[model samples]
Target: MAWHKKPKTNLTKLRIVRMIVQIIMFFLLNLVFFEIGANWLVLPINMPQTIFSSSEGSFFLLQRMLSRAIIPLIPLASFLIIGGIFGRLFCAWGCPFGLFQDIIGLITSWVKKYEPTHSTNNSMRQIGELITGGTLLISTFIGISVGLGNQADVEAAFGSFFEQPWAVLSPAVFLFTAIPVIVYWGVLGELFRIENLGSIDILLWIRLAIFIGAIIMIIYIPRGWCRWICPVGIIMGRLGEHSLIGVGRNITKCNHCGICEDVCPMGVQILSHPAERVRSVHCTNCLDCIPACDEDAMELKIL
Candidate 1:
C-alpha cells in the first residue's frame, strides 16, 4: 500500500484576490464620499453614538435597531461577536484605511525599496485605545445624561453630541480622507502627476495631524496606522471578541513555519503556538495565512 500525502497551501492566489477586493472597495468609497460631499446626492448624516468624531459618519443601523427596542440587542451583539471571531476581517477586506495602506504600500514600493517591517512599539497603539475608550465613555454619558428624564431629551442630547463631540475626533475623516488630500496635493502631487489634493480646516487640523502622523509611521511598518492610531480599529477589535465567526488552526498536523506571520499585514503571530488562538486584536481575518501555509493547517470556524 502507498502512503498518501496532502498538498501544501499556496497563498499567492488568495492574497491577490484580497488585494483585488480591497482595491475595488477603495475606489468605490472614494467615489461615494466625493458624490455625497461634492455633488450633494446623498445628505450627510451622523451617528448618535459615533465611536469617534468624523464629519462623514452615521449610526443609522444602530440608531434604528436601538430605537425600536423590539429587535433584541442580539443582532448588533451577534455582529460584533462574529466579526471578532473571524479576526478583524472587516479592516483588511472592508476598511478604507486598510485599502489606503495598500495603495501607499504600492507607492512606496515604486519610489524605493521598502521592506514590510513590523512597528514594534505599542505605546502609540495604547494611546489610540485610550482615546477610543474615552470616546465610548463620553458618548454613553451624553446619551444617559440627555435622556435622563425622557426619551425626547435623550434624542436631543444624542443628536447634539454627535454633531459636536463625535464629528471632531473621527480619525477616519482625517486618516481616510482629509490628510490624504493634504499630502497628495502638498507633497506627492507636486512630485508626481497624481490627482492628489487636500483641504485645511484650522479647527480640524490638530486631530488631522494625529491621523497623518499615524500614516507617516506606516513608512516604518505596514499597517502602522491601523495598528497604532485608529479608533475605528479599536471599536472593531473590542467587538471582535466573542464573535460567533472565527478561524481555527490545526496545530497537531502543523509545522511551525512562519509564512502566515509574514503575510499578515496587521502584524499578527499566526503560526506560533497552538493555531486556534490568535491573540493580536489587529488580525484582519484577511486569510492571508490560509494560502500562505503549506500544511493546510488553518481553517475558519464559527462559535
Candidate 2:
C-alpha cells in the first residue's frame, strides 16, 4: 500500500527573474529620449519600432533594408548568429512585445488559456510562414524596382508601403511609436476638441485595429502573435530548431506526466524532443517547463 506524490511547480522565482530581464531589455531597446547610436547593431529580436526606438531588431531592419534595395547582410547575419547560439532565447528574455504579451497573459490568468490540438496548432503556425514569405516577396519586388530605376513608378503605386509595407501594418509600431506620437503631439486632444473623427489617418485606424486584435489574441491564447502571426518568429523558430543551447530531460526523474507541454507558451511538444535536448523550434528558452515539472526532469543544457 504505497502512494506516489507529484512535485509542485515553483513559478515564483523564475517569473521574477524573467520579468526583471524583460523590463531591463525594454528600456535598453527603447531609450526614446536619447540618441545612443546603436542602430547599426541589430539584434535577432522582434522589438519592432522605428521613430522612437533606437535599437533595431533584425527582422525590422531586414524589411527596411530589402525594401530600399539594400542586401541586409548585417540583419541576416545577426539572425543566423544569435539564433544559432541562443535559440530564440531573446524572445523570452528581451523582446518588449513578448513582455507585453506576458503581461496580458498574467492579467487574464483567471481565464483558461486556449489549448489547440497538435495538428491544429501546427496548421495555425503556417500563418506566420505565409506572412514571412509574402512580406519578403513584397520587399524583394520593391528592391528590384528600386535597383532597376523604377522607384518613382513603384512609389506612385505603393506610396509609403513601398518604403516599408509590413511596418505600416505592424502592431508593435502602434504600441511603441503611434501611441506615443499621438500623446506627444496632442493629436488626440486636438481631435477631441474638434470631434473630427474623419480626420483620423486610415493607417492609424488599421494599426489600432491590428493592435487590439493582437492584445485580444494574447489574452486568449498566450503568445498568440508569437506563435501564429509574427514573420520574425518563423525565421527564429527555424534556426532554433537545431540550436546549441536548449532544455534537456533527466530520464531518471521523468515519469512522462506531460506537464511541461502544458505551460509552454509556444505550444512545443517537449517530450517529443531527444532526451538530452528539447530542441523544438518554437522553444524561446523561457524555461517555464523546468519549474512546471514536479519530477525535476528538465535541465538547461548547452553544447
Candidate 3:
C-alpha cells in the first residue's frame, strides 16, 4: 500500500500572527502609559537607554566591583533571563527598530521581486563579531577605569560620555526623539506661530546620516544592524548560547532541502550541522524556518 505525503505547513499564517503581535507590542510600548494597582507593572523599555544601562551593569559586575549609583537592573536582567530562555526572540518579535527594518525589508523585497540575501560572508560576520565584542570590551574598560576611578578630572571628562555614547545616534533615538522634534518644529510650528523652532546642529546632522544609512542598509541586507552592529543583540546572542528554549529538528523527517537555511535572515547554517537544535548565536527564534520547512521537520522545543 502506498502512503500519501503530508501537506506542507503554511508558515505564512504564523508569520502574519507574529507580525500582528509585533505591531501591538510596538504601539503598546510606545503609546500606552498606565499602572497596575500600586505597581507600575508595564512601562516602555527605552531601547537606547536600556542598551547603555545593560552594558554598564555587566561591566561593573564583571570587574568584581559595585556601582555606587543605583543602576537600573530591570532591563538588564530582563534581557539576560529572557534571552537565556527564548534566545533573541525579543529582537525578532518585540524591538521597534527591528519591526521598522522588517517592514522596510518586506517592501524592498516586493519592489525588487526577490528577497535580499542575508550576509553570509565569513569576513563580514567576523567584522560584526569584532565590532560588538570590541564595543563591549572598550566600553567596559573605560567605564571601570575612568568613570569609576578616583581621578575627579578624568571622571568628569568621561562622565557624560559614559551615560550614553552612541545612543544619541541610535535608530531608537531618531524614531522616538528626532522625528517628533522635526514634526513639531517643521509642521506644528507653522500652525502654532512659533518661529523659534531651534537650530540644526552637527550632532543632528550626524544622527540623520546614521538613520538614513541604517535604512538603506536594511533595505539591501536583511536585519543589517542587528546582524552586523547591534551591541544589544550581540549581548543577547551570547547569553542565548545557553538558552533553555530553541528550535529543534526531527532529523528523520528532514529532507535536507536547505529551505530553512534560505529563509533564515541571519544566514545561519541550519542544515550544515548535525546538532538536534539550532544554537547559532545569530538565530533570533523568529521561526521563519518552521514555515520554510516543507517536510515538517522543525519545531520549537525546551532543551
Q: Give the number of the best model, judged by lDDT.
A: 2
Task: Encode model 2's per-residue lDDT on 182-208: one tens digit a residue.
Answer: 888887778646567687778777778
lDDT for each candidate structure: 0.54, 0.82, 0.62
lDDT at 302, model 3: 84
Candidate 3 Cα lDDT to native: 0.62
- Give the better candidate number (2 or 3) by TM-score: 2
Q: Write the per-residue lDDT of candidate 1 for residues 237-262, one digit (tens) a residue.
A: 66654555655688886777665665
Residue 157, model 3: lDDT of 63
Name the regions of candidate 1 deviating beyond 4 angstroms.
Answer: 1-10, 26-87, 110-124, 148-166, 175-201, 271-273
Clashes of 2: 0
lDDT of 1 at 78: 37
State residue 70's C-alpha deviation in candidate 3, in Å: 4.8
| Two-way lDDT contest, 2 vs 3, winner | 2
Task: Give per-model TM-scores.
Answer: 0.64, 0.92, 0.75
Q: Distance (Å) between predicted and true CA of 222, model 1?
A: 1.1
Task: Tell me the TM-score of model 2.
Answer: 0.92
